[model samples]
Target: MTDEPALDSARKPVPAGTPDADSAAAPWWTRAVVYQVYPRSFADSDGDGVGDLGGIRAKLGYLAELGVDAVWLSPVYPSPQHDNGYDIRDYQDIDPVFGSLAEFDALLAEAHERGIKIVMDLVVNHTSDEHDWFQESRSSRTNPRRDWYWWRPAAADGGPPNGWRSAFSGPAWTLDGATGEYYLHLFARQQPDLNWENAEVRRAVYAMMNWWLDRGVDGFRMDVINFIAKRVELVDGPRPSVDGGSPMGPQIHDYLQEMHREVFAGRGGEHLTVGEMPGVSVSDAVLFTDPARAEVDMIFQFEHVSLDQGEHKFHALPLSLPALKKSLSRWQDGLADTGWNSLYLNNHDQPRLVSRFGNDSEYRYESATLWALVLHLHRGTPYIYQGEEIGMTNVRFDSIDDYRDIESLNHFREAVQEFDRSPAAVLAGVHTMGRDNARTPMQWDASDNAGFTSGTPWIAANPNFPGINTVADRAGERSIFRFYQRLIALRHESPVVALGAFSMLEPEHEQLYAFTRTLGDETLLVVANASDAPLVGPLPVDVTGGDLVLGNYAGADGSGLRPWEARLYRL
Candidate 1:
């Protein structure tokens, strides 16, 4: 792979610190903060151990109070519970575990009534094998719907067509004994990839999207959307990897443009479409999110998050603050003139932000708010994952049996049985890097099961919930939740925070994360000590005469930054 150019590389540049003239008429989401709700872990109104639509509806008041502009719900569609509802069996209906379609509508109505938009998780790239569409296609090789999915003949040696590996740790292709062909699944064997090359498939996906739009949903958080278009020729590779096949294929842009024209055209600028692109480069992201291209409002690029990741998600590496800064700065510089950005540090698929990047032990509150300040001040639409606002942390289960995520389970089996790694060592990795670290039940109160459910939860709540739950945070004078509320409000009120040009202050600073946001005559300086020890170096920028706008500590000043201290200055 070629290296991405430096920040000074030639590219189209928007005038520094000036908001786009058209931004005044742009969609509401340009400056909006979105909250992602993983349904299974959000709340369980039924007390049946799983969060449901009613649970989400019940929490609308809490979210509204938090001041987010939208709630992006993870998939709640009918499924066999494979991939935690991502393997959709039916696109138009709600799963029984999440409540019926009527309950979803009720949640939608309540969210809208609270002046919050509802963004649905659109998972169209793959479907559960139980889906009728896949069942029919796999019935026979000559079936009319056979082209709906990727079906390939066995190789000369009667093996699979490619050396692709599933994201969850096995072979990407599953051989169907009855059909004598192999079907591709980038994730799990149960989730077969769809053939975007099929015109009928594209049309069907667009139709389903339109159906959701007609039902009054605000937009979509597309799942691994960049994987939809595969290379025409499926060649054998060295071995299976996390990303099974080629991504961001030639026709990806075409498919997105077609989708926009068919599903969202003339629908006004109210809808927000953000594609989750796993392997997208800055250049490709520019083309994907450029307003004139009409492909998507913004795209989720993974460069920054992958800095600490090694060969796979579980193999952790030391995080370099300089490298992280370079990666983020590159994206800011690349998209300054053309595309928009979606800034986030935590999500359903990632471990807790504070645990992964901050001190989640003694300095939990300070570090949590510090990271929140840094992320929200960037020039992008920020996304807040569920439970992150209250400083929720990763779970530490004693045994692998306590985990539920398919990816973690598969990794454990492969590492211990196949690779001859020690079981304890593998479990330690899972404790630190597993997806289930983020999948623990949301901590609402200090009650049993963290008040997530009256019955035993599907997944155990983080044991630290008593001190980190929402109720406690909301009551504390100095809490992460309160800090998040102020940050959200600042984004809504200050144009400089939302649309300003970003400039890094100290690109190679080891302990300090400093940046400036500029818009017209207004400039804001953000400084944070991302370490547990006190920062005693020269300040990156002079804040001598600037007005202190927001800070985590009560007596924070320009003298010196305390441990995990974050401050915003209006200059």
Candidate 2:
């Protein structure tokens, strides 16, 4: 399915609430606020300079107090650190840098004890070349596990099997002299794409998933899940393509259905499964998330976040607020009937929200608070990336040498060395969209290293952490952290915020993102001045009888909204 129209709510028999009757029973994930913990950057307990499970365990109380129902830990599994844990070396064990299995268990126990669930990052599309399976597959062509990863003879022209290129800017196929074959890798060469067509591979994946489920992992945030099934014929991608978008393969649904049958069938609907779909449209997301099909509960779509990127993520442009409203409103309506959306402004993969989307300098507090109101008040589940609750801004290192992300390093190399691009422009782009922006250490206090570690950190902490940290924010009553707490509390208290029918109020307004959330007789108006300038608009209807439910500022002036003001009203 391509881009389907916004779901028709009139066809629904259930009261006009969020989702259908099937998913509305969503015991947890529906209205839950999920906090994503980049394990390596969260907090370093033992002073190994890297964050560990012990650190997360010690901080469970903080997350519980933050009002989040769950924490989505970005891959803590064993890896060679090639892609900061995405290139998984072991699926079952915790990385030594993070901690051991015992520590993970303790962390999980503490999280659950505090009424918080933990969902693991599932990276099934590929595995680290150092993994035993990949090692065995690469050992010999006749090995039983040789087909575990995609392997093929070189093309007639003595090149890769197809014109495929890696998402990080290299040939997608890597030649292995030992076997005289090319293996496909959409990412780093060390991350070989798995041969999902092989039933053994599928079974192995299913078994791994079951192991996690039985081990009490509440759910999974499957990474690049849409790329699990590629075009079986191995046809070349479109000309001059970069292997970045979601792989729209014909057998994708079949594989998902099989996965559900084998892994999620008897588990019931309590588990949350959110697919991180890179290029999936609104309609495809519906197919993936409709609970009746037992596929997934929600999906993280990239279109809205990608609006500011010009063609590539590295090339940045000022975002258009109206366009952003149009895109977000479509998804809100598109999935109103069949599925749900995962709301986020920042994550481990993207830049910080205040830096990229909101005004981070003069009106940082107001803008960040405005964002908290806008994102959490939406129709679907909301995700708060580590440090986003405190309004963490992007970091700009003096040079690229300080950057550790493989994607950033690779693109910087391509930009300066191969393309003859100006280093200044390239560096600026990296500062704007680099994954390192969100990878900075969590700012907990004003002490050395932001109190993240007693020793040197693996990555440098943002220099501005002293002022924009948890301790500082907590001391100050009206800070971004407190605003986020209020937002989460609203989600728990107001069913109108949880299951309201979403509709954009003033779609044509340039600097205003105004929308209405309706649930039966209650209708809540959400208006935010998404810019640094005051906005004056005509009052089409008087909001006299409504209660001023939530706002960043205390008193309403009645005439207009000040710069970066966000308010919610319920009638």
Candidate 3:
């Protein structure tokens, strides 16, 4: 492990969002839009039914033309595929299924040549049980590396250390047959949680991070970063809630600050870092992302995404537009003067945005563009998941065998066999909330396998790919892809869109999602009808009078918004 310096407690903290003398020029990410590529489903180049780095290199032109400033690849590192690459076996090596290290370097260079940066997904919260570090740790109770992971003795009753549940639906602790101890795994048993309490573990992680930065990687989107610091005493928590005595331990900020100092202190201003923080409150987010703290540039919060979830993520409920607006508005206002927000509706772990939040049926185009318009105009950095620009919908697999995500499959078994759930009802929930919905191969064209691969795809393509593929959308008159392009361009062209103060309008109106962005002398107003029916109501006079900057429908004269209609105005 590398030698790391301790954090400076005597240093005074700077005010949130306060720029220093050297930072007169804005950072690249403030106005930049990022696109996420789940590599296995992006494109296949080897005809092995799996996407690889070479496949991404072949599509650089498409992403460059799409106007994304950065491409965030989700976990291309070597893994056992237990959690779809999240269970990393090697931190520095690319998975053989994805390609080799040389191929990744080539892709990075090509992306840089095309004026797009590469951001790797950092998944250090846990390591695959097959990882060299964990293998040595679990070799024996008295091994030198035994403390690298959380290994606890069996309870008096000979059960798990606690009653906490796994995110995939089982005991959070898995008993190790060799060592006669249970190892903590917040996720799948194959993924054992690393003990951050060990200084060597922290140093090792920082060293690995510095290695990536030295290799010219732009930044990282840290996975489950908030869970790195765990409670010292692993006590029992509420049943079936996966709390395990609150995973958000007190030292999270300290660990992040130390990580920033050791890994990113002198790495220049071009790099971007965003943490995926579940259950992070607005106040905590401000502290985590405040520039003075040197923790991260931004964070991906789950409050807005958890709006429609009941009890758990798979137990779906109807989305309330007003509630969604309120949740988003709170974050907007909370971080307006402090931390930055990462705006996104879809990602690898979530369902499609169009299918979940917008009308994916008759008004797919309108609703897709409407959602994009609303999200990009907010005062934050926006992210576009693969196939989101083409308005991809959720897939309804007839049987559980067609799904490939471990989360979905595990939940089905636990629900039906363990909890006595109806198979039909469980399948229905899976259709709406399954992670597999976003993992389907990217629909590039209307060809066999949706042009994602020449051979059979690892997962089945959405049957609606014939009509919803990118080729058709790019060639159509009312193109969702074009709409996204314009939105990205607008963010780059206007400072008001990136650094404006957000103000939510008509927060109680169930059908209208309205907001304003104000920066200095300029103000931008965004209005959209989030319902299926046309909205006929009296709007503000200034909104009707402002110049129309962008709209989803033609000749939207501010008289009233059509079904799923959206418009941006410069007031």
Candidate 1 per-residue C-alpha lDDT over 1-571 given as tens digits, one digit per residue, 9 for 90 to 100 = 1122111111122333666623544446756899999999999999999999989999999999999999999999999997999999999899999999888888888889999999999998899999999999999988999999999887776777877778898778899999888999989999999999999999999899999999999999999998998866553343343445464478998898888888876676578899999888899999988766678888998889989988778888877888988899889888887878899999988989999999899999999999999999988889999989998898889999999999999999999999999999899889989989888999999999999999899998989988889999999988888899999999888888877889998899888899999888889999999988999966788888999999999976676799999999998
Task: Give, for candidate 2, the lowest lDDT window spanning 10 residues.
Answer: 2-11
Considering every candidate listed, which one attains the maximal lDDT? 3
lDDT, candidates in the order shown: 0.87, 0.85, 0.88
Q: Please give the RMSD to the true structure for each candidate, in Å.
A: 4.8, 4.1, 3.1
TM-score of each: 0.95, 0.95, 0.95
Ranked candidates (lDDT, high to low): 3, 1, 2
Model 3: lowest-lDDT 10 consecutive positions: 7-16
Cα error of candidate 2 at position 502, Å: 0.4
- Give the CA lDDT, 0 to 100, for residue 29 in model 2: 65
What's each prediction's clash count? 0, 0, 0
Which has the better lDDT: candidate 1, or candidate 2? Answer: 1
Error of 1 at 147 (Å): 0.5
Compared with the true structure, the alpha-carbon lDDT of candidate 1 equals: 0.87
* Candidate that beats the other on TM-score, 1 or 2, i.e. the better one: 1
